[model samples]
Target: MPGLQTQSIHAGRSIDPSTGAVVPPLHTSTTFERDPDGEFSRRYAYIRAATPNRDSLEACITALEGGDETISFGSGMAASFGVFQALAPKDHVLLHRDVYYGVRELMEGFFAKWGLNHTLVDMRDIDEVRRASRPETKLFWVETPTNPLIEVVDIRAVAEAARAACALLVCENTFATPVLQRPFELGADIVVHSLTKYLGGHSDAMGGSVTLKNKPELVAQIRDFQHTGGAILSPFDCWLILRGVETLVPRVRLHCENARLIAEFLSTHKGVSKVRYPGLVNDPGHAVAKTQMKDFGGMLSFEIRGGRAEAFAFTAALKTIARATSLGGTHSLIEHRASIEGKTTRAPESLLRLSVGLEDANDLIHDLDQALGSII
Candidate 1:
């Protein structure tokens, strides 16, 4: 197998046979021409069913994730919904307590109406996972280094429990990315990613994907949903995501480096109450993260000394970081997770999530220092 950096650049990419172009051309045509015998000459029939760009993106992602099959969706939420759509009615799902709020809303709203069941558990506890398993439990959905809180789940342990319960284990590998973690090697059946984040790198393209290992039936269902359900990403978006995948290696390495520096600085700062980053030896998830992940990711969260007021004040004073909702962009973003999540949010009032970017570590530290100083 090629090194990850080499795969990132060369996987699913080939010299254009027709135009002799090195870069894959964006296939903007929604419909393809048929042969004289009334047979389709190419693998693609319609943009809704398939496209060259979407195929290229899916192939690249499958290679990166080390999965046998892959599917692309219009957005991260759409990709998540595709998993539920693949399951039968009344099938149960196990979710991490601090999963991205959108997944929670999906289950509580639409999935509930459709008779889908869910149990939210602390994924760090394998015992809790075992206790929560029901005969009908068809899926174990885990988000390690969970959104906002940065709590890392032991993927191998959770996979063991999921396997024992005869359930499909799916790891949302968005935060860790394939560069940091490969869930399949840890025994997960599926890997999900919000390509809008780190995979797209620029945060300009919006897309989602599922990479499957040893699950042909589930792959078919997801492919059906993608084909007939009408949430397929556009060719232009697919092309953009492929372009972003080219530089994923160096980008994530720097992201991890900068975040480590930022987290270390925040941990000892007087204005900070606590820092949640797996890179820190003292972090609750540090040991497990070290076991499963090649590098601690670029995201971390910390609690301000005061409550929501201080959290908001700190973000308001930042000169370099932007107050934003999304992550994995080139620019750093800070969000008060509790405010965004509202009443059901488990995040502390003082907690702030930071999406560390490809910025100078010292400059980011200085900006954070000034912001915290203003709050004091």
Candidate 2:
């Protein structure tokens, strides 16, 4: 097997046979021409069903995740919804309580309307996972280094419980990219990613993927959903994501490095009441994170000494860091979780999630210092 760095650049890549172009050509044609015998000559039949760009992107992501195959979707939420839509009407899904807010909305609104039931549990607690399992539980959904809070769940422990319950285990690997964690190696059956984040790196492309480890049955089902649903990624976006992934290894390394420095700086700041970052030795998730992840990842959150008003003020005072909703971009972003999540928020009123980016460590520290000083 090639090293991750090598695979990131070379996997699923080839020179153009006719043009001798080093980069893969973008295939934007929605439909392909048929042969004289009424059969398609190319590997692709139509854009929605298949395309060179989408195929190349899928192959790269599949290799990165150490999975057998992958299915691409228009957005991360669409990819997640595809899985939920595949389940039987009454099938149960066990999800991490601190998942991305969009997932919460999907389950509570759309999936609920479809008659699928869900149980939200602290996935880091294997005992709680075991206790929550029901005979009808068909899927175990996990999001490690969970959104906003960065709670690192033990993937191996959760996979064990999922196996015992005869359920399919799926790990959302958006935060801890394949560079840091490979859930399939830890015994997960499926790995999901919001390619709009780390894999895209630039936040210029919007995409999602579901990679299957040795499970042919689920793969076929999800593949069918992607094909017939028509929510697949565009060829241009696929090409952009492919470009982003080529530099994934180096970019993620810098993201982790910058985040570690930022986390440490925030921990000692007088205005920060508590910091929730797996990189911090005292963090509740640190021990488990160290065991399963190669790096603690780039996302983290902290609570202000005061409440929502103080958190908002601190964000407003920041000069270098931007106040934004999304993560995994070159620019740093800060968000007030309570305000965004509203009534269903599990985050603290004083909590702010920081998507630490590829910025100078000293500059990031100075910006945070100024922001905190203003609020304090």
Candidate 3:
């Protein structure tokens, strides 16, 4: 097999047969012509069902994740919705207590209304996972190095529980992209990603994917949902994500490097009450993360000394790192996750989530030092 870097550049890419272009041509046509015998010989009937660009993007993700098949969607939430839609009404899903706020909204706000059931549990506790299982449980949704809190879950342990319950295990790999962690290798049945993050690397595109590990029946079901539901990723966005995949390896390496330095810096600061990063030897998730992940990943969060007011002040004082919502881009971003998550937020009132970017490590530390100084 080709190395990750090599695969990133060459996988799903080919020279244009007719134009002789080195890069794959972006196919924008919504509909394809049929054969004279009323056959769609080219195999693509319409954009929603399939498209050249989307197929190429899906191929790249499938290869990178080492999955049997991958299904692309317009956004991360759409991909998640596709998975839930695959389950029958009244089926139960076990969600990480600190999973992305949007996912909670999807289950509690929308899916609940449709008779779908869900329960939130601390995935770090294998016993908690086993205790939460019900006869109707159909899925176990996990997010390692969880959103905002940066809490890591042991995938292998959780997969065991899922197996005993006869439930499908779905791992959200958005934070720890394929570069740092391979969930399928760790026993995940399905892997999902928000291409809007690390895979896009540049934040210019919005997309998501669900990759199945040898589950042919599930693949067909989700593919049918993707086609009939019409929430497929756009061709242009697919091309953009493919372009990002070419440099994912190097970009993620730098993200990990810079994040480690920043986490260490924050740990010793008096104004920071806690630093949540698996790279830290003292972190609660350190041992488990080190066993499963190649590196600790780029996202981290810390609690300010005071309350929400202090957290807001610190972020406002930063000159270089922007106060932003999303992560995995060229620019570093910081957000008070509590405020963003609203009333039901589990994030500490003093917590700030930082999305380390491809920037000078010293400069980022200095920027943080000055901001903490201002707040202190």
Candidate 4:
């Protein structure tokens, strides 16, 4: 097998046979020509069903995640929806207590009306996971280094509990991209990602994917939902994601490095009440993260010493890091997660989630230090 960096650059890419172009040509045509015998010999019938660019993106993601097959979607939530749609109505799901807010809304607000049920549990505690498993539990959704809180879950341990319950373990790998953590290797049945964030490193594209370990039946169901639901990722976005995959390895390495430095600095800062990062030896999730991950990821969060007022004041004072909603780009972004999550928010009022970017580590720390000084 090629090294990860090599795979990132070469996997799912080939010299264009027709144009001999080094870069894959963008196939924008919505429909393909049929053979003289009235057969769609090219294997693509419609844009929604299949496309050259989308196929290429899925292929690359499958290789990166070491999964048997991958299905692409218009957005990360759509990919997650596709998984739930595979289950029958009245089926139960176990969700991490601190999963991305959108996922929680999708289940509790939207899917609940369709007879789909869910239980929110702290996935870091295996006992909680085991206790929450119902007889009808069909899926266990886990997001490690969980959104906002940066709480890590032991994927292997959760996988065991899911297995005992005969449920599929679906891991959200958006935070720890395959460059750092391969969930399939850690016993995940399915791995999903929001390409809008890290995989589309520029934040220029929006897409998502579901990669299955070896479940052909589930793959067929997801593909059916993708085609019938009409929420497939566009060819242009697929091409952009493919372009991002080429640089994933190096970009993620730098993200990890910068986050480590920033987390270390925040831990000792007087203005920070607590720092949530698995890279810290004292972090509750540090040991588990070290066992399963290549390195702690770029995302971290910290509670300000005072309150929400201080957190907002600190964010307003940052000159370099942008006060933004999304993450995983060339520029650093910080958000008061509680505000974004609204009334049901589990994030602390004083907490700020930071998405470390590909920037000078010292400069980012310096920016943070000055901001703290201003707020304190």
Compared with the true structure, what per-residue lDDT tens digits does model 1 show for residues 146-181? 998999999999999999999999999999999999
Model 3 spans > 4 angstroms off = none
**lDDT, residue 108, model 4:** 83
Candidate 2: tens digits of C-alpha lDDT, residues 290-336 = 99999988899999999989998999999999999889988898999
For model 4, residues 1-376, the per-residue Cα lDDT tens digits are 9888888888888999998999999999999888999999889988999999998999999999999999999999999999998998889999999999999999988899999999999988899999999999999999987898999999999999999999999999999999889898899999999999999998799999999987999999999999998979889999999999899989999999999999999999999999999999999999999999999999999999998899999999999999998888879999999999999899989999999999899999999999999977
The window of 10 residues in a row where model 3 has the poorest summed lDDT is 4-13
Q: What pairs collide in candidate 4?
A: none
Clashes of each: 0, 0, 0, 0
Candidate 3 Cα lDDT to native: 0.93
Which residues of candidate 2, in runs, are more than 4 Å off? none
* Distance from true location, Cα of 163 in model 3, Å: 0.5
Candidate lDDT values, in order: 0.93, 0.92, 0.93, 0.94
lDDT value, residue 332 of candidate 3 = 97
Give the TM-score of each candidate. Answer: 0.99, 0.98, 0.98, 0.99
